[model samples]
Target: MLAPLILRGVNFKSGIVQGPLAGYSCAPFRRLVWQHSQPAFCYTEMLPAKQICIEHGAFNRYTSRHPDEVKLCYQLSGCDPKALAEATAIVAAMGADCIDLNVGCPKAKIRKKRHGSALLAYPELLYECLSAMRSATQLPLLAKIRIDGGSNERHNLLVAQAVMAAGVDALVIHGRHWREDYSVPCSWGQVALFKERCKGIPLILNGGISGPKSLHALLHKTGCAHAMVARGSMGRPDWIHYLSGPLEGELGSLSLKQSVRWLKQHLEDLSQLESCETVRLQARSIVPYYAKQLSVDSAHHLVRIIRGSSDFKNLMLSLKKIL
Candidate 1:
């Protein structure tokens, strides 16, 4: 039997989570995933905790969740405890079902700010941040961390222990060190080792889970409570359904024509929820993901047209012609 993942009394029936993609996991993308894939939960892109605390409208974009996104987790990144606490409170008040601290982002900008994966190097600060956030809300709190800050597995274990000790409800481990790139395979062995020490706290395994086969293998290997999909679900948001099995009334095996129609509907929904500029930018960014499913000529043509056009209607017309 597939065990459900429960965090703070909320039952995640599927145990398949949509990990936050920094620039791409915005409201429109999340809505697209929710409508098509129906992951147990979806996260917003990482928001800067300090900015969300200081700026009046900083969370507007992050908080624009779809009505169906009842299990949304707001992921926050920052080095300050006070700021994190403030931001957590605001996120909870904004109707977030859970809060996640981002400590696994390996981007240069994130590390330079001593946020994201940089926090792994300073266990004390990470604990303080988690503790503050825990005190701020009764909502489930989670920490998403890399396997190791340095090359040492011991560092990873220490960070996991500290995060759990700080009262975090769950841990999401991306099975790689901060210095390791995606080219390096994720170490599910390391995740399993960490899970052994986690006592009863739920552990969600992430990294390189591209499809159902890998997802199942990783789950069996790591004994993780859940699996979180990130880059793998890019153009194929229906991957969640493929991995978790389709929910009742969910469509299966979309044809190329149906996929194109779905893309059109996604763009239309995006336009209604976001500004024109945002719609155009998001459309351009996401269109390339569909290229792989198209013929070589159509793929190249789609990329060219999307890159050159700023108007959504014109872009859609070009896409329709190519599809």
Candidate 2:
């Protein structure tokens, strides 16, 4: 159902996309996504406008893109219009295929900083920030936002209108309110409601969509042009292929042998981008996501090995022993 939709002038090879996850959607993981699912393009982790303005080219984990990530989109957050515009220009020069402004992040820390969903409360400022970003680059621009329930619906629509008026190439609408948690269901009605209001602009539906199949179903339900996969790609990087590629595999999960191989490659990719100390600490957290696809005992075995490993090289050796 997802055709190659054009934004500005870039062609997203697939309408399905690997959306940005704050901590998990780093360069190494996205590189793995590209090798497996190859859905449109993967967005880099959310970047702070002020941070990008200060550390545009430095060796930063959040800013590093894999050399193979040809169609990368940079998602930027901040309330400062100048900082966003400057950040936009910097990423554009850094080879961003498209840029997205994160207006839907619901984390309290992000809101308190007036950077994420907090900006939804001030339409005027968001409009200014977006307009400045628009003026910065001819490259495609987008804004991602969340829906608020009941009394706040009108204001939510206003924020959508504001970003559109500011010249975002498209909009990504999350079906839940900023105050709501993921445990709350993603309201397809809310996503459809935004589609009704912003009739002409291209919209990318986010939230609760795990991969291409559900994404296709959501598009039919909401009339959105495309969809973004978030939590669905955790551990199962090969998810999109089940929907559009070979159906021989059940439920899009890789085999345990394949999983171990991919996991090894993931760690190897991280080795080039981050130091051994960073990889060792991060591996403890990353294993659980991969563990999700494994049987309960296998998952536990993987986790224990990663957690008990004394060092980074030990971590790899332990993973190799799993097979």
Candidate 3:
């Protein structure tokens, strides 16, 4: 069995964490996860450090955490040291359990700003940014970085060493380069190599962990301290509970009716917490996942209904009909 992770004195009961998914890991989505699945830790969507530093209410949306989220880690991304430090302090003041620097987002827009995985190419700058954030607050600092800018193991190792040397509490490494497509297999061997190189700091393996079986296998294979679940758990909020095993009965025994009830509750919660525009977008994005559980014709019809409806009430009604 994998032991619980202890990062800078905070104890996480499970080794699994919900990785930050930009638009999807917002307040309402997190609330659903906490209420249903109960992952060891959860992260806010990546908020830009520069925006937090410049805009008055920029952190407002990200910081609207539920009371149940005791282990929330607010993730920030930026290339500027000063902005990062300011944002770290702001997040700490907002009662975040930990602060995570996002250096592994592979989006082209993020890379263009020299943020996210772009930092992997600039070791010295990444170290400086980490150091500045470390000095800004006493909160536990975590960094999420890619394996390398390219496929080179040596380069990945050097970056991992530098991240540790800069005083981060834990490291989350995605096992592929930023430029690589998701079709390429994640380098679990490279993740194992990182574990070998960075001995003491807790290494949380991100990417390629789709479900409980893969999570356990990766942990065993890499000797990683923790795993972060990403796209796998998007619409299926119960994934964490399923992985935790204690709630296996709930997942295993859920009938289609029960699943539909759960999906309805999730949609209702999102409607109450977010604006109509957000609800519409979320419905479009998440409904397809739930549709997969239904027959192909029904699923297609349901998606079309969800996509076409602008009103939340009509969308919910149409969804209920399908269920």
Candidate 4:
């Protein structure tokens, strides 16, 4: 059974909530979390609602929850209220514990479609969308928003109030706006205001969270109930546990060889569930995250290892030698 976990008014099986990265939150990635980490809320890659209606098979795959996926969630992006709500209903019936509306994604395609952060400019429409979703299903609804333009504090506050009024169970705030790319910087001060406006709502903060020090600063300053991780958790599977508690003693700083061994095991598991092509892509995806922790040459070697045609066995062997 999924453990009972709650954030503000919304109850989930696990207090942990995984940040939905567009291409990376595949079944194998999510399954890894389900097995190794605490029972946590894991989101599917953002599925456009219209696509959900037309290609139900892909929707099922995107939103599919393993039996172990206790608090699985489907994140939908669209400008149409009815289509969005209808899609949410479909996934809910398919076994989603929560349905999150993606109003924070800043990707070019999503914005041009007027789906993601573009919705922030039309607050009333955003309200209507969430309200439609609220009317359609009893599953917990979450609204993810990036800080609005200009003053982060002001924009986030208004967005929070509107979403809360629309009856979302929780709010996930990315601490940066669409304009502020990841390279700029994060605004912890703005995040600290979340507890002020929506005292009863769970505000999960995202942005610039790379490790323990940042986590500690943000949590203490914001007084938020939970933290959502995005790019940071790519290769470091144990990051959440690492931040939430003390390190795993001697194994805390895993050597490069240890990392290769672990990653090879993860690759094998991924192969069982995904195509070789996908495994290769995912390996490419997480390599940079692991690369950062190693020396420059070792990092370059990791990149080569992921890109090369060697089988998973040879890849691990090569990484072991490089480390």
lDDT of all the models against the reference? 0.79, 0.80, 0.78, 0.72
Q: Give lDDT tens digits, candidate 3, residues 1-323.
A: 45677887878787888889887787767877887776778999999998887773343556677666658999999999999999898888888788899988889999999999888888889999999999988888999987753565346866876787889988988778877876677877777667776778888887776556667778778766587877766666777778777422344534455546656776776666678677777787787766776677766776788788878888778668856
Q: TM-scores across all candidates?
A: 0.90, 0.93, 0.89, 0.83
lDDT of 4: 0.72
Residue-wise C-alpha lDDT for candidate 1, range 174-198, written one tens digit per residue = 8888889976788777776666777
Question: Which of candidates 1 and 3 reaches a greater lDDT?
Answer: 1
Q: Which is the leading candidate under lDDT? A: 2
Counting clashing residue pairs in each candidate, in order, gives 0, 0, 0, 0
Q: Which candidate leads the pack in TM-score?
A: 2
RMSD of 2: 2.1
The alpha-carbon lDDT assigned to residue 51 of candidate 1 equals 80
How would you encode candidate 4's per-residue C-alpha lDDT over 1-323 as one tens digit per residue? Answer: 11234744555644447788776776656766666565358888998899887876353446555565657778999989999888888888877878899998888888998899989878888988999898889988888888853453346666766787888878888878787887667766776566677777677777776665666667777766577776655666666566555433222665677567656656766677677666777788777766776677777877888889456656656666755
Q: Please list the residue runs of candidate 4 whose C-alpha ends up more than 4 Å from where it truly belongs after superposition.
A: 1-15, 57-61, 149-154, 192-194, 247-251, 269-274, 295-301, 310-323
lDDT of 4 at 143: 88
TM-score of 4: 0.83
Ranking by lDDT: 2, 1, 3, 4
**Residue runs of model 3 more than 4 Å from their true location after superposition:** 56-59, 149-154, 246-256, 320-323
